[model samples]
Target: MTVHLPILEAFVKLGNYLTDFCENSYEKPSDTHSKFEMVITQAQHQNGWFTRENILFALKQWGDLLTEEHLTAWLSEYTLKYEESPKTIGIVMAGNIPMVGFHDFLCVLCSGNKVLAKLSSNDKVLLPFLAQYLIKQEPLLAERIEFTEGKLEGFDAVIATGSNNTSRYFEYYFGKKPNIIRKNRNSVAVLAGDETQEELQALGEDIFRYYGLGCRNVSKIYVPSDYDFEPFFTAIFKFSDIINQHKYANNYDYNKAVYLMSNFQIRDNGFLILKEDEGFVSPIAALFYSYYESEEALRKYLTENELQIQCVVSKQKNTDDVPFGETQKPNLNDYADGVDTLEFLLEL
Candidate 1:
């Protein structure tokens, strides 16, 4: 189980590239300001916000997290056995957020696999740049990494991320191969009365980061019927500035208008609204409906519909109490949708 020197070197280079790209490429607020202006202009032409500033921020954050020690440790732990020879894995990426497919890319590469990554149209820059950097660091990996805008075939296995609608297509197309098909999933947050102010503030990051467009964003809030909404709203109110941002304001006004015209009763406190519903995912900026009369009822509901939920953010002192704001930026150990990706890769 000796670690391969070449692979380790490539991992180090990848980390350096990420660090330089984040710090050097877009270092100043002016840089971000200009990018935001361009994004707004592009957004006006189309119906989507490119979110370039947020992307830069996330990349910088990820670069900081992917330290040399961390990368080396993860590589050593995950790639020890397959260092000499690795699996060839093809990855179909998702464009839900900035480099949303990066974790999958890291898992495959760290598991000692040749990575053939198909970049999402919404995110076409970062991965290719990373591949080129890796090639320069370790020429041996040049053939191991590739970027494409089209379909990829003839890999030992595949990992594809898509919506619930496209999952069926992914299954039919790559079903014959060893594959992991990821469908749409929304995260949830359960608020116990005991959360500290600091924890709640960090939880706001989970709720508002990337304007709630990410799958790991808290789309549903499960609170006790008697629980006061004041603290929660108070803690999250800092994100009110996001409402002033045109992109988020548009979504809020659009949804609010729909509610008004459709005559759907929505309880609004100006910042956010509370509605009654039975699902995990919420409409953008609009929290979905559900209240628990008792902890027993909440437990019953969770047990009954466990399959529909991804991770639960809570301050409880048990497995049920998922930490606040840790949903989207999962640790290396946090497997996606509760599936152990490393284990699956190893088994294949």
Candidate 2:
């Protein structure tokens, strides 16, 4: 029952086909339409958050990562010596965004383990569809992947992703099992006030992608004291069309009203609201900003709240932050909550 690496490589090939079709084809094929094409519609209907753009973005990112070369390179650093000790790894996935819990699923499979996935109701269809596709590509995979509708059981270890409150429940229930229970984590950006207009525009993607629902999306930014926001506003103005989205607009309007009633000063460029606050998670369509006296002070703040922070975006030298706007474009090894998922699975 050793999970051959080529079986996983075939899985990547199937992913490429699915993603390329989604990204390139606009009109549905008359009769030649494949099974994968139907997933886009199914995913959207199942989860309102799974828009065409966001689902396609997630697919494309996986397409880029699931290449034969990329997969080989990524797995080269680790030994596949754990195939002899395969364990059932139960996954309690989160459906905040399209395929948000995919990394854990991928990690478990790549580590030569059996996956018993309990998908979030918000995102139930996509992963199961992908798992079916993988089974089709490599029939042996059918033995390894299973999706459960009821409470998860018969698993030696588990990987669950949820909010801070739900994590306590996970801890209480799965405390004895070897687990990687992820709580809430939000990414942040540190502005040096010297970033280019292009960089700021890229930062808008880090903020607005998934309507700021992802852990990788930046919910807050730290700027230097007295930093001029003219360029920042101007750069992000291009994304004002986001207000056209019904869900996002509703959030924008509601958060704006709450802020106004509370007398908290907020700057609005129509689509997004910018507020000065000392917080990590901001409401949708609103970005919280705080002032830092110096780079050192910002570094100190980041270090102190290291666990709460996912990734830091900046362009300055000598800092350990990720490059501006690359938070969501994480490498395969960039494990969530700073935990190496594959390493955990392999050791289990």
Candidate 3:
């Protein structure tokens, strides 16, 4: 069977609804939008990290990308061959960021596969609510999507996302099936020491958005040995209010105390902590930094460690570098862990 056009249309309508609702351009009051607001509230209540701002940001990004033109362009690259009986794709979602696994969900559906989604408990509210909206738009979608709180069974293929530790377990469990298992990866920014204040400010968005809890967030930076952080600090001062959130402040205080007790040198503003560490993943409210002697050596290091990195935030776009502030706003084709999810689904 060919890919279903109604499924595509349903998602486009969902994209329009999300855009209008987020932009406050909805022509009139409707139950869907009202209930969507409630779902956002419920999501935040379920997960403290799912703050209203972050959820809205995720929604708006999806809205902007889910347009007909963007979807068409994205799908044009794929030969969306479908089986006579759609394969049931079991997706194990991660909850670090709101609707983080939505791209996999989209891939499964658009490739004419059934989705048996196992939502992370922390992110249970948003996708199911959106799924209901999509089902409302096209009733055919109701049969294609399934949510399960129990162990996922009766699926032909699997996609799972988790930390490095849990990935071992996923491999053991889902290894027999056709699977795409993602492990922990963090993004890093390569700073040339000549970035403008505006670029640094935009880098702050890459760092602070989602409270540094996302894989695409710049948890680490590669800076010149003589780099001055004063300008970077000054540019990111506008985001200082992030400390007002209790959860973030608690993490800030805790990590600061730990570093201080260990007598490690750390750079601290009132809100953000910068530690000169050669690690990729940083704790919430903290950033890790490493000194780079030359661009050639840094490029070599990045190429060698590409598997551990999700994105490379830079002033210039390389094949894999995401622009400073656009890490979280990934295009539909920006598959996680550099895996082509749509192609995987179609092959299944």
Candidate 4:
């Protein structure tokens, strides 16, 4: 078998293992259960925001997406012609959510390139564990992946994910190389106020998942002017336990106090705050909302701020918006910032 086939097969096994791992914390004596548990505990200790449930949610999402069928379907869209001499693609991963950069790593390997990964300090453990799992399954892949603690060097191209401010530095430093430098982007939901209680409740997951840290997490919603927040708030009560998390609670207290002191008119449901703001990014524990007079207004604003937005969630039969609550469950093809990583790797 070719090297790529073993890698793909290994990932498929890893996905199956992860699905079983999340469904049941099986204490197989020889398995990596103890190490995985340590990594989860360390992740939460290093970053208060990285809760065990959130990390597992991310893991399950990946497990579902990393199937053979999904990989084949995503790769079918491209003619994955690799460089004669495989290029080194440096990936500066984001620490916002667990395994946020795994897709890029997978894409690099799928495109027959090498990965030079510089992990974020906050999310250092899990990806390495997965990589080790892959290499153990397919020893040939051990040569294709490398981790660097110091500065990234000898890379032909780079894929970096960071805030908008850090992107400037990335561009200045990696300008000469073929690179994908991702910046801040937020997701939004368009609610027509007539959605079913189920749909509205799912929207709550989009907002509350990962404490709204991911770019795919819905940070804001656009609703009709006469939208009644009572139904919306009621539907989201299922996620009320989120505030019990001390980090989330701290943000809620801090932002709520700031809003109250500033005399800003805000709606609260004991745990979450809803404020009227025209911004895409909202503070943790608070979601910004804007009253849309018409679909045309929302379209115009979206066009003007296209780069700042990630995915749009709505029930309308529109291609632009994702179904409610599925923002975080992106397929392999849902490239970040709409940039196709596989295509870039092929070109390189």
Residue pairs in candidate 1 whose N, alpha carbon or C atoms collide under 3 angstroms: 277-289
Residue-level lDDT of model 3, residues 36-97, one tens digit each, is 88888899999999998898899999999898899988898888764458889999999999
Model 1 clash number:
1
Where model 4 places Cα greater than 4 Å from the true spot, the runs are 1-3, 27-30, 81-84
Q: By the TM-score metric, which is better: model 1 or model 3?
A: 3
Whole-model Cα lDDT of every candidate shown, in order: 0.72, 0.85, 0.91, 0.89
Q: Model 3: which ten-residue window has the lowest total lDDT?
A: 24-33
By lDDT, who's the top model here? 3
Q: Per-residue lDDT tens digits of candidate 2, residues 242-274?
A: 899898999999999999999999999898899
**Which candidate do you rate higher for TM-score, 1 or 2?**
2
Q: TM-score for all predictions?
A: 0.86, 0.95, 0.97, 0.96
User: Model 1: what TM-score?
Assistant: 0.86
Q: Which candidate leads in TM-score? A: 3
Which candidate, 2 or 3, has the higher lDDT?
3
User: Which lDDT value does model 2 have at 5?
Assistant: 64
Clashing pairs for predicted structure model 3, backbone only: none
Model 4, span 1-348: residue lDDT tens: 123566778889899878878877755533577788888898889888898999999999988987888877777787765444788999999999998999999999988899999999989989999899999898977888999999999999999999999999999999999999999999998888899989999999899899999999999899998989999988999999998999899999999999999999999999999999999999999999999899888888898898999998999774778999899899898999999888888887
lDDT of 1 by residue, 173-202 (tens): 999999899887777787776777788887
Off by over 4 Å in 2: 1-3, 27-34, 82-85, 317-319
lDDT of 3: 0.91
Select the stronger candidate by lDDT from 2 and 4. 4
